[model samples]
Target chain A: MIRHSLREALLSLWRNRFMNLVASFTIAVSLLVLGLFLLLAHNLRSVVAAVGSQVTVSVYLRGDATEEQRDRLMDSLRGRAEIEGTEYLSPQAALEKFQRLFPTMREVAGELEENPLPASVEIRIAEGHRDPDSLRQLAEEMKRLPGVDDADFDLPWVTRLRDMVAMARAAGVSLGGVVGLAAILTIASVIRMTIYARQQEIEIMRLVGATRTYIAAPFLLESSLLGILGGVLSLGALYAIHRHLAASQGGLVPVLRDLLTTSFLPRSTSTLLLLLGLAAGALGGLLSLRKISL
Target chain B: MVELYHVNKDYGRGNHALVDVNMAIEKGDFVFLTGASGAGKTTLLRLLFREEIATSGKILVDGMNVSTLSAFRVPTLRRRLGIVFQDFKLLSRRTVFENVAMVMEVTGVPRRQQRVKTYTVLEMLGLNHRVRSYPLELSGGEQQRVAIARALVNEPALLLADEPTGNLDPNLSWDIMTLFKTINIRGTTVLVATHDKDLITRMGKKVLTLDCGRLITH
Candidate 1:
């Protein structure tokens, strides 16, 4: 009987080819959009961590500051709990670093006799003090230090990037939830139509003493297959779209592909989405079956 | 055996479909439920099959209260009761062989035995040659026979047939009734609901007559 019901379900899916197609297509499209947003959010989070890790506060020294004053400032920074480490680059070292980072800038710097670059102390803040507000406060305190010409770091933009990543993630969650609901509703509507189409046959089955489960099992299996198949196809479509983005080098695709370098959704996330699809299908079928009597 | 005590089934708004109906039938008995249109004969059989619960009253079939059987237990009760309808109610998409086999499917019978039993029943009903034919291809009498075959395949203890011959001519009606008699002799109690007075008189069976939802005579 189990085999019979499964066979009946498969046969019914084939028999109602058009409706099944429509249902599957709707699920696929919805899941695909959800996957795209998730991928983007996942990538933006990576950007926030990467940018956060690379930024620091550079406290440039005045040319008139004595060696003793520079040494005192370095000791003060090292004693602070929020300052993880520091690197002091002399004027010559700073000019050498500049020449190495930008080859084109070396010609302009070489034309000047006195390597006119300020000696600066680059401070690496502790993880707890990495946010823009904390870095700005620390920079303000360092600016008042003796012989400090300027204290600055590329803080605002990285902080903005972190905020944007968080907002995008929240939006992704809402979008995924809305799309999942739409998929469930679509499956339920299609299953309801199937129930109506077989109303006469179902009535006869009930008359003959067939249990409600006996009649409902096949519909559940059919809808479940529809949803799972759609989920798998969405996964494949997302993969293909990412591959295209990764392979091409022109236009905005390259910028987008940089974020997607971690690959499609993680294996666990993929499995979860597939399971969610199957559950949605089963739930949809049961919702409609509730209206029927055994 | 079947028993009913003060069985009153109200459709709604105080309109009773069956009013104070009382009846009983022993095992292996053949009884006719006779009444005019709107007489509640169908409602009475439906109650026996547990299709509709009584608004007030008690009904016991083989010691199980038909009116109060739990939802899950209804299928168990129905398995022991064969039911037929005037329209034949055969699944048009299935062949005669599958249609008959489907009844046995619900009982979880082995497929091989299901095939054997279905073929035997079809052969007995003179449908062996049309085993592969769909219901739409069969005549009304043949379809009715298939319905009877399906009802009998499970060898139910009781058969509740509602208006079994309402859609047939006199000769076809008598033919189907003869099949019922044969089933009854085999120890399956048969309760048929119909208004065919000619056949009712011809068969000379115990007839329970209903008038306006009330038992006029038994």
Candidate 2:
């Protein structure tokens, strides 16, 4: 029965190649749009994670601070419950770190008469205390220390980044849902047309006592094949677009290079997309069959 | 074997397709249902196969009550019987072999068995040489024979044909009747519905006549 149904589905697809191709292309375009949003959401999530993990408050010391005041500040920072850890950098060490980070500025630093960079202590916040309010309170308290010149953290920027990630995710989900529904409807209409064309054959089959399942199996399989084909086509198009953007050297490529470093969809996600395609096709086939009394 | 008791089929709005039609055919009997157009000959045959359930009656075919048969069980009942039509109802896209083999395929017959059974039936119907030809490529008589082969490939217990020769010439129609007679001789009960009184008189079989949805003679 499976072999027979498979043959029937393949034959039907071939006979109505033009219409099936149109349907498949429509599905492909829909999936492609959804895939693009998913890719954007994935990259945003990665950015949020990377930025959040590196969040810290930096406290610069006064140039004229005494050794005793510096020691006292270090002790106070260590005693704070919200502080995960702290690393102190001397004036010369800070200069060296700055040069390493900004290689193009190394020559300018070498021409300086003396080290002008500030000595600072970097404070890593504990996971539970990393919220904007808590970090602001910690920074304000540090700024009141005797040897601390200023204490600052990019809490607002991090918070904004998180919001952007959330928005991207929500938009991706909503758009994907709408596009997926459209794809299913397209497939259903295509199958309906095919059923109409083969009405005579179907009537003959019914007259000869073909079971409902036997008659419907080939159509169900055909829809699923269309969905799977569309999925593969979308994946191919996505990969091609990704390759083009990754290889381009001008325009927004350089500006967005940091975010574009993100990899393609993971294997698990790609597999899930394929399954979604199959489910949508199957659902469309079922919807088309509802009105048919076979 | 078939039996109809008080068979009543009513199309809504004062249209009664069959009225209190009571009849019976013993096992292995060959019978003809003769009537003018719209006289319920097709309706009676359809009722036997549960295509249109009788408004109020009991239909028994091969010991199964078809009048009360559930929707899902209709296919099971139909598998035990073969039905041919005036138009032949052959799939134009499929070859003669596939058309005939389709019956066994629907009933879940094994592929190897389907091939053997399909070939044997075609050979029996004298259509062996036309197996590879499409329906449109065959003559009217050949197409009808292919339809008959499809109906008989499964070796049904009963065969019901509705105006099977309506589109064929007199010679071709006679040939089809002879084919049915041969099938009857091989022990398959046959019930044919037709309006050709001349063919009926020539065949000399038990005849059941219908007039205005009422069985008038037997």
Candidate 3:
């Protein structure tokens, strides 16, 4: 019976193409606003993920530390929280790594009689626990160890990037919430006006003995359909924005080294858009139902 | 069956719509409720349909106390009754077929069954050819016929017509009154509220006259 009512409602909407178009237009505009924020939220997450993965906090060893003390320091660093992987690089290994990175630096090393570099324990923090404050605390704690002279984060750019990403995430969530609420209100009012215009028809149906559910089904279905269409339109708009961003500001997204880096909308975000559209439509229908009678 | 016992309807501010109206209508009986303008004829119909509650009296239709009927269950009571409006209240946007089929649709009739029943009713009214036509495109008589078709499609146990012929010419008015007669003959109780003296007198049937909200005769 409910399904039949839905079919009837959709049929009624289809019959009034102009009215349906007006309704769809309202829904589409709301969805565009919603999708824009969703894209921001999604990109913020990706940016955070990229920067977090690249963050590595390295601990420098004391210049005169004994091999045993260095090994102990390595064990202690390994046991610490947020430590990804640790490598105890001997002064020669450090030199070799430096030489490998800059072949021209080998001549400078060759000119010096004594190796000036210190043997260091390089620590990488796990992506999940890579918070700036937490990493800074961990580094300080490691430096306090008897064999460790100082702690150095290999990636100096991570501090600013982490802060920027955090700010972006906060802003994105805030914008997303505001835009989502606006979308709901927009759809609700549109549906409300539509229901108001048809109040007479509804009253007639009520007088003619139509059930509340019978009258509500069509409106609910229409709302849902509107939401779905809005969702699709939002997704399309979001995608277009993403493509334009990637073209105009391709390098804005960090870690562009890997070709896998993309500003595309996430699968979850797209699914959310679809669900949001449907939910908006359903909610709009309910809102209109509450205000109008059968 | 319908019965109104000492029904007094007051709309606040000392305005009385129906004053102690007492009347009784038997099952499958036909009746004309005659009165001039503002004589409580429409109000009487509204009371029977449970559209308005009598302030102080017992009103029962088909053994259900309408005066005490809750708003929620009003639709159920209405389902057993068919109402014809003066304006022919057909949804002008819908085709004649859809307009008539809506009643059966409300009753949860399947599409196929509704189609068959609607076609049968339209055929009976000799409107089978105009089934696909919109109500606005139809003449006044045809529109009235469509309204009648909608009211009768559900096979309601009770039928209420409120000034059904107000907009019709004499011939069309007679035709509509005859349509009501044919429906009443099919074992459906019919109550027509109209000021058409000639049409009412010619049909005879039981007459319930209202004078300024008071039941003058039954």
Candidate 4:
């Protein structure tokens, strides 16, 4: 029975090749839109993770503070659990680092009578304490220490970046949902048209004592084939677009270049996308079958 | 083996298609249903196959109540019977071989059996040479022969034909009736509906005649 149905389905598809192609292409375009949004969300998540790993706070000591006061401040900071580790740069060492960073200004630094760069300690925040509120509280505590002149961190910038990533993900989900629905509906209408074209065949099948399942099997198989074809087509289009963007990063702006460096969807995600296509196609076929008396 | 008791079919608004029609045919009997157009001949055949349920009476085909058969069981009842129509109803896109094999395929016959059975039936109808031809590529008589091959492929217990030869010429119609008789001789009960008076007179078989939804002769 299955073999017979499959043969019938293949014959129908070949007979209506042009209409089926149009339907598949429409599904592919809709899936492509959804895939593009997913790619954007995926890349943004990578950016957030990269930025989060580098989160740190820098504390500058008062120039007139005694060595004993600075030592006590260091000891207190080291005792805190939120401080992962700290690197201390003396006044002379800070000046040397500044010269290395700004090579053109090295001559001006050399002409100075004394080192003017402040002695600072770079504090790495622990993974568990990386949230905005925790980091802000830690910075406030550091600023009140006796030998600390100021505590600085890009708190607002990191917070805003996180917010933007969240918003991008939300938008991707919404757009994908809407576009996926449209793709399913398109497939359903296409199947409906195929059913209409084969109405005579269906009536004959009925007269020959074909059960409902026997009559429906071929149509269901046709819909599923269309969906799977659409999925493969969209995946190929997505890969080509990703490859083009990745290969032409040199001409892109700094932000876009960074985004281009991110990898494509992972294996599990790609498989999930294909499954989505299969489900949409099956659902579309079922929706069209509802109208048939069989 | 078919029986109808007070079967009434109405198309609503005082338009009666079959009215209180009652008849019986024993197993292996060959009978013809004769009437002019709109004489309820077609309606009587339709009721026997459950294509259109009777508005009010009982229909028994091979001891199964067709009048009250559930939708889910209609296929089962039909599988025991063969039905043919005026239009031939052959799938034009399929080859002659495929058209005959379709009946067995739907009933879950194996591939090897389907091929063998389909070929044997085509040979019986003298259509084996045209197995590869499409429906439109064949003559009207040939197409009707293919339709008969399809109906008989399953070896049904009863054969019901509604104007099966309506689209053919007089000679073709006689040939088709001869084919039906040959099939009936094989012990399958046959019931045919037609308005061909001369053909009916020549065949000289048991016939049930109707006039305006009422059975006038039996």
> What TM-score does model 1 score on chain A?
0.78
Residue B23 shift from truth in candidate 1, angstroms: 1.9
> For candidate 2, lDDT tens digit of each residue in A1-294?
899789989999999999888778777777777777677767777877777767799999999988898899888877778787999999999999999999999999999998998899898887667798988888898899887899899788878977877776678667777887888998999999889988998888888898899999999999999989888888889778777788876666453543543678778877777777788788889989989978
Off by over 4 Å in 2: A57-84, A87-123, A126-154, A253-261
Q: What digit string (tens of lDDT, one per residue) describes model 1 on residues A1-294?
A: 578679988988898889888787777777777777778877887777777777789999999989998998998887787887899999999999999999998899999988788999999877778987889898998899999999998877877877777776677667777877787788888888888988988887776678878888888888899889888888889889888878777757565667765666788878877886778778777877888664
lDDT of 1 by residue, B114-208 (tens): 99999988988899999999999988899999999999898899998999998998999999999999999889999999999999899989999
Candidate 1 Cα misplacement greater than 4 A, ranges: A55-155, A249-254, A260-262
How much RMSD separates candidate 3 from the native structure? Answer: 4.1
Report how closely model 4 matches the true complex, as a DockQ value.
0.68
True contacts kept of 3: 0.60
Worst lDDT run of 10 residues, candidate 1 chain B, spans B100-109
lDDT of 2 by residue, B36-144 (tens): 8999999999988878888998889999999889989989999999999999999998899999998988888888999999999999999999999999999999999
Q: Assess each prediction's global lDDT (C-alpha) against the native.
A: 0.85, 0.88, 0.79, 0.86
lDDT of 1: 0.85
- Two-way lDDT contest, 1 vs 3, winner: 1
In model 2, chain B matches the true chain B with a TM-score of 0.99
Query: Which candidate, 1 or 4, has the higher TM-score?
Result: 1
How would you encode candidate 4's per-residue C-alpha lDDT over A28-115 as one tens digit per residue? 7767777776776678778777777678888898998789988887888767888888889999889989999999999999999989
Give me candidate 3's TM-score against the actual structure.
0.82
Candidates, DockQ: 0.51, 0.69, 0.58, 0.68
